[model samples]
Target: MPHFTTTDGTELYYTDQGEGQPVLLSHGWPLSSDAWQVEVKLLADNGYRAIAHDRRGHGRSAKTYTGNDMDTYAKDLAELVKHLDLTNLVVIGHSTGGGEVVRYAAQHGVGRVAKVITVGAVPPQMVKTDSNPDGLPIEVFDGIRAGVLKDASQFYRDLTEAFFGANRDGSNVSQGAKDDFWRQGMLVNLAAAYDCIKAFSETDFTEDLKSLDVPIFLAHGDDDQIVPIGAAAIRSAELVKDGTLKVYPGAPHGIHGDYQSELGKDILAFISK
Candidate 1:
């Protein structure tokens, strides 16, 4: 597997395929580049170079005890993009990966990225504060941290359904999908996974969203059980200057799984424009 070394000397694995305008993918918390498998093939088949990387401590990357926060995550991404010499890139981030993409651009000045998309992203802040009353409470994240520390494997298994709304009786996702998700989660370093809970939940992306000059598309599911659309996608769409929000009515957190066709069509159209 191809990999790149971060500023902190951690090796992060990434996949690059096809050729044309580059479309870089960043996966969500506790997940790996594997999560973007569908979109990567879709973009590559459509004449675009698709790149997806495993965040540090997840997937095939190093499982370090340090630098598991947003700042480090963003810095790691910037180095990877710069090392590859990709320009005019359309960066797509999902869930917590969205936070990394926005923060990288905001803090590092976009590098060579021209467009961005955040799917089921966490931004404009996920934790509640005096200013953002609608945000999820700190207790919610605490519960997650506590759960992971107690029994990470079991925690991940239980989260399989809620994370993607697969618990529904008529849910379209297969049993294998949930198992795959659990497999990836369990592969991650326990220490790193435990630390990232704070990073994803507490980091503020409001400034990052405000600083962007590029166009951003925020696609989210209204019925998202993990990151609610109202607090995440809906509010994130409102913060960016040139943001386009698309709400998948009744769709759950795993929009790509059940709504792959719609997401693929829309993503291609957006990239074209």
Candidate 2:
């Protein structure tokens, strides 16, 4: 198992494959790098070196009760990028991973990064504070914490429906896709999953969003039930220095899987330009 030791000495697992411009992917909450398998293959096929990692406490990485917050998550990624010595990289993050990339780019600067994409990402903050009065309420996250504590397996199962827009009438539901999501969610440490609920929900990314100096692509689904398009993705594109927004009609939060082919084409086109 290929791995890198974080600054705190935690062994983190990652997969590096193909060859060309480095494209690093970050997975969503309670999920692993397995979530990016389809996109990885597509990127590699399109002539880009694709890399993805399981966040500490998720997938094959060590499960720790502490250091499960966003800062540590960003730092762990920073170390991985440095270890690989990757340059002119394009970082794509989905859901919680989107928040991670924003913070990482801000903290580390664009010395190595060429572009960034946040798909159905939680950024510019998720939880409502005095400044972010329009953000999601704490009760929404509290419910998630409760679900993880009481019954994570079933909670994850329910998440797939909510995440993929399966709850919507006339929506196409794929059992295999739901199963894949459950499998990835189960691979993560329950404690880490629980802690990340707060990490992703509360962390403020205002400073991070304001610091970007490279092109940022904010792609999101208009019908995302998990993270509203207006509050997150739409608002995020507006904050970045040079950001572009692309919203898919009738697509769900997992746009990477729902519209993999089209999304890959768009990404390849962006990277080529």
Candidate 3:
């Protein structure tokens, strides 16, 4: 297993494959880099270098009690990029990873970046506030925290249904995908996973999204149960300096899985442009 030590000495596991324009990937909350397997393979096979790292406290990375917030998460990504010495990069993030990418560019600068893409991402804001009436309520996130504390395993299992739109009529999500989702969710440390609820929900990425000088592609499933399109992708596009928004009808938050082929083609096409 390949790993890199961050400034705080946390070892984060990552994978690098293929060649050509570098494409850095970031996974969602409670998921390791394994969640990006399909995208990694697609990018690599298509002649782009695909790189993904497990966020600290998730997957094979150190599960610390602290530093589970967005600022630290972005710093870790910056460390990984510095370690690899990559430039003219395309950074793609999913869900919580999307917020990380935006913060990374805002905090670390985008001199090395060529483009940014976020899929089923959480940005601008996810939690409801005075200015953001479209966001989800804090009670929803509280319910999630309660679920994680009471029975993390069952929480993940139940979440898999909504996460992949398994509960929808005419849905055909495979059992393997649900099982894999559960497996990935269980790999994170309990404390870190708990902390991440606040990180992803409360951390405002409004200023971060506005700061990007590079072109940003915002892709979201209109039917995403986790992060709604109107509050997340749509709002984010408006905030970004140079943004393009693509909505996938009838797709779920796990668009990278169910809509893999379509999402892959869109991603490749975006990068090419």
Over the stretch 81-112, how does candidate 3's per-residue lDDT look in tens digits?
Answer: 99899999999999999999989987784788
TM-score for each of the candidates? 0.97, 0.97, 0.98
Score each candidate by Cα lDDT: 0.87, 0.89, 0.92
Model 1 misplaced regions, further than 4 Å: 109-111
Q: TM-score of predicted model 2?
A: 0.97
| lDDT (Cα, tens digit) per residue for candidate 2, span 1-273 | 799998789999999888999999999998999889988988898789999999999998998788999999999999999999989999999999999998988898469999998889999888888988878999999999999999999999999988988898977768888998899898889889999999999998988998899999998888889988877987888788999899988888875445766787788888888
Give the residue spans of candidate 2 off by over 4 A: 256-258
The residue pairs in collision within model 3 are none
Which candidate tops TM-score?
3
Per-residue accuracy of model 1 over 81-113 as CA lDDT, tens digit each: 889988988989888898888888777746587
User: Which portions of model 3 miss their true places by more than 4 Å?
Assistant: 256-258
Backbone clashes (count) for model 1:
0
